[model samples]
Target: MRPVRLSVVTAAAAVTALAAVTGCAEKGDAKGGHGAIAVTAKDDSCEVSAEEFPAGHVQLDIENKGSKVTEVYILFPDDRIVTERENIGPGTRASLTAEVKAGDYAIVCKPGMTGDGIRRQVKATGGTVAKRSPEMDEAVAEYRTYVQQQADETLPKVKVFTDAVRAGDIEAAKKAYADSRIGWERTEPVAESFGDIDPKVDLREDGVADLEPGQEWSGWHRLEKALWQDGKLGPEATAFADTLDKDLADWVKRVGTAEITPTSMANGAKELLDEVATGKVTGEEERYSHTDLVDFKANVEGAQKSYELLKPVAVKNDAALVAELDKQFAALNALLDKYRADKSTYVFTSYDKVAEPQRKELSDGVNALAEPLSKLAATVVK
Candidate 1:
């Protein structure tokens, strides 16, 4: 969707608060449960006190008192750095624990929020540091291999659906389209690595439809007619196609460029959930401009394309998969109607400005669909 647009004020506030917190301390006595450093953010900067930390492992407690979201990063002498939890919203704190060696290091808040929070330099002395063992290295390597295998298996299935469509076999096209939903579901855990692109919104709920009995299917037929037959695609239709292409390209690109590790996806998912939380909490109607709606629509379409790509894999294995997908499709349509009604009735100024609980309910409902839909991807392509 349209990149999340934060006001300059909000951005500055978050950055400043983060900076202040990171600068606070180097080491502190183990408190509560572990060796911990407490840092607090105020305004746009964070305040960190200096301290001596145990060398083997350390924990950082980041407390935010501002009105924006913030992230923390730790920089080391050898250019090795660790990004702490991100999108820590207002009034919340996150603790990050890591094993660190004795060395000079810097801590800073991420940019884009109050420019960048403060930075503090610290030196760890005295204790023995843990070194990576061969076993750990081997585990990491094995995980990488597994991710590559998954991607390799997924891409070809996606290609099958697209190739079928390109061949213009209406029946094969429909079956292939239905089959491709598995591809997206299969790669979702991997796909989550891509930042800000929500698979639930971008791939699960939108795209070209199967030649089946439904309004969604008919919508796809109408689009094809307008594009290939009439040779006159509307702005909306053109935009939808573009998103479909982009979503596919993104998946393929990740196969080579992305790390495909669980950590990558987990980190991305945290950021996404944070953004969704921020959007839900702020209730800023102005944030959902016309451009935002257009982006939202594109994301919905991307999710649809992903469904189309994996549908064949799903239907080939279980007819029930199609039924479930159709159910979600219908649910999304109903949600859209609710949003429209709320907008027309001035229920909360705008769709984005709906009550926090309502917004969260909507986001959670959509996200829940991803789990079952994702299971189809694990089934081998038939």
Candidate 2:
């Protein structure tokens, strides 16, 4: 998801934070056990405890002493994210974990949640860490397969949507819209990992300010505004739809090569919850279509899928956390079920139809799940 630009959350009862990528390390005892690194985030500086560590399953224990909510990233020398933890509020502390091979890397902290951020040089200085347990490797393999499957399924649905838009069939296009987004929403972190794809296909108009010059806002939301808000489907909209199809096709082809790790999967699950809380719950995501619940359900499903894949290792590390996660997922799912028009279909009541009190319940459900979910990466890596 894009960095939040709107002040809409102040009016809604939900978590006020930007959606971000993966996280690392154990709590306390930050003297570098279990591949731990400590970081202090301030308004003007990002201070990392050490620049070197062994390869594999690294954890970052982060403390934000800054006034603004911050974001932290462990990046490849090329600036691709190895893992990240975002929306760490003032005075809060968070732990993020990731696996890495021997290489030079950077730890970046973005205070106020904007710009390229302050950078600190770091390195993983040894050969590949010992192989994890067979089950852990299997979990990563299974998640990679799941992510690829979602990407593969998305291209065909997106084509149907694009074709409908081109035909100027308003009802058909509207019907296909939510279906097209489900697969993308389910595995958004994977798409986002590609760096350029999400901004092209998922960036909303409000996020335009975050883009560099010459980068135009295109893809689903642009077409969404045309079909719902503008109520017009001209050649321009059709052309953009075709472009969206190509961008998504690119995502489908590239997702298989995306980095997948046990910690990344665990952190990705938390990212989905953040997606729901920041976008879906506030109804900012599907502003024109009012289909936020469709995306909401898909986000929850994606989070649950990641959790389930990692539950075996996580349960071994912390049985209580697994139980809380299971409970929270079920609770959230049940709440979403209330709006389902039918159990067999993806159909749901439009988000605009939801009342304020109901929205609060949804927000509370998301926050409840998000807290425990944030610990998943560290738990699994432990």
Candidate 3:
């Protein structure tokens, strides 16, 4: 999970900026080809073209005019992510199409891809979004079922891992760790959409900088450090295990109500690849255990599952893109298989054991897949 840093923009400053932006804003439409919200992301500012738009399938045409790589998001008032497009390199242009319900939302651009991001308040006016075919509706239902199933499957495994940590069985916890994470990894974007859950369950030490004051750090990586880095399952580690269990249980119970859409499914699939690229490929996620490959495979599987579910509509929309996606998915999976210790198990060579050159190969594979995957949302929404 990417950390949420404190925004540099203070409340008074943000209010001033919003007032100035509101004066020049116009109402935009999503159906008449005027739904594109033009965003210019810079080092210190995020400028969006409009302050209001018709609800439905809205498109964000983003240009990173900044010195650093950036990310853009549409967030609810409470900061729940409606949809987001991340990892846009400097001087590049990217587009994101998202389904928005009529409500107040914020258009955000995170230059350097951190923090609460520079924010501009926007509203989605009451209107019908793009119509979906029956098949598309069915796909969303099936994907929802799949996400819930993953959560259901994950709880028992997490119990085993947390139980081991509580019992001070370091070896058993180490063995249970990777297996427990697979389900969560597979549906991470969905979990993250809830805004409150992922941080409690998956936040790493690097994310401590992003924590709000009075929010204590306790989760999987905290327990992971006790097992591998500190070489003991102390009292704090046991407490962290309990905290992780409680947070994840909340996630499993709440996941079914998460909003799932065809565009979201497509966008989420791309986000999974981003997770692999940023965390798994860099060997930063499972730093102590070096079981990054297990998470890597699960992320890929999740992306592929989303693509497969949307393939019918996507293929009907853009056959060439579908063909390319299929090819890249197969190729990347084949490459990952080379590192597998056994076909029957999720085990693979420890990430620390992976040479730099092999890591680059994996990174390249991710980028290759990511480029096309980025277009999936627009494809399915079309």
Candidate 4:
């Protein structure tokens, strides 16, 4: 919807939105693949050796034969990228796991890492995944379904919020803002699945680069300033609202097709906490309206949900890790919960209101949770 605007003022936990949106995959190729599928990236094209693959893990051994830097994506149904690696300098060979399922999918390569790349459909034979255990397969499937549900929940409500803003009914927009955010916050990682949409929709001011003479920032925060700081919604505000509406509606529809693996989920959780440490803990997120607490709470809730859904699998892999995460999550949540202003909001006048001692406690707890959570991806592979 929109953010509350009582007076001239302003607000990752929201970076959970940023990090989730901007994060991509690359490590050692241990994430997926039963055998390497040779890929070649050239100045004009990306060529994968195989047109069809058995459902399961497959290595994409890519050589950037092209003159320009290139990146590769394993696109699932609806063009959702399951995994990608960027900046493959010419003549460099890179590898990543394509943890795929039985479905129709595509491989896309961006020669200069901009715009939609050339696409080629590849069929994935169903019924078996040689590189994935049955349990791991099910876990990924279940997480994908969960992300889809959150997207479904987001679509219609966000429409209402945007409508309120377009109508210039500021009070109505304010009322609808928080609820509209919940679905998005819950599926921040899923939002990241869309290649170009996230940064455009939820970009915070901190991400703004030194604009030359022409660049302009836009997104929810831009609109937040209009309503909260500027204290009025000008005619252009309607256009900003329109963009947010269109992007959120469009992305939610495609999100279900995204591949969500345990490795990604594990990495996503750690990244969310990192956002908390770097942005939320420091009060860098909510610059105008002071709603950083709102995003902070959402990030924790989203992280907790990720941990919960994967708890059984995690416990199976390492009970000790799961136990430690449980304790750390509880500690952090307990600290944050005390700041709850009311049943619905948090009390911090600003993030700076938090004493250094308390801030350190929060930071320490997030750090504690992150260590165990970061290990989750490899734990799943083992």
Best by TM-score: 3
Off by over 4 Å in 1: 1-34, 51-55, 74-81, 101-106, 110-139, 150-382
Tell me the tens digit of each residue's lDDT in model 1 across 1-382. Answer: 1122111111111110010111121233323235367766555666565555656556577776677776666644322223344555677666655455565666665433433346666666667644434533443355455446655665565466445455544445444432343333334433443432332123211222311224231222333343334544345554444454555666566545443222223232233323333332343211322112222222333344445444544466678867786687557446545655453421222454455686666666555544344344323122
TM-score of 3: 0.90
- For model 4, where is the 10-residue window of minimal lDDT? 4-13
Candidate structures ordered by TM-score, highest first:
3, 2, 4, 1
Query: Candidates 3 and 4: which is better by lDDT?
Result: 3
lDDT of 3 by residue, 66-134 (tens): 899888877656565656767777877776666666777788898887666789988878777656799
Instruction: Name the runs in model 3 displaced over 4 angstroms.
Output: 5-35
In model 3, what is the error at residue 113, expressed in angstroms? Answer: 2.3
Instruction: State each candidate's clash count.
Output: 42, 7, 1, 15
Model 4 ranges with Cα > 4 A deviation: 1-130, 210-216, 341-352
Kindly list the per-residue Cα lDDT of model 4 for residues 176-239, writing each as its tens digit. Answer: 6656766676667567665455666666765555222253566677877777678777679898
Q: Per-residue CA lDDT of candidate 2, range 234-319, in tens?
A: 99998999899999988889888777777777778888888898889899999999999999999888888989998999999999
lDDT for predicted candidate 1 compared with the true structure: 0.43
Per-candidate Cα RMSD to the true structure, in Å, reads 15.1, 6.7, 5.9, 9.4
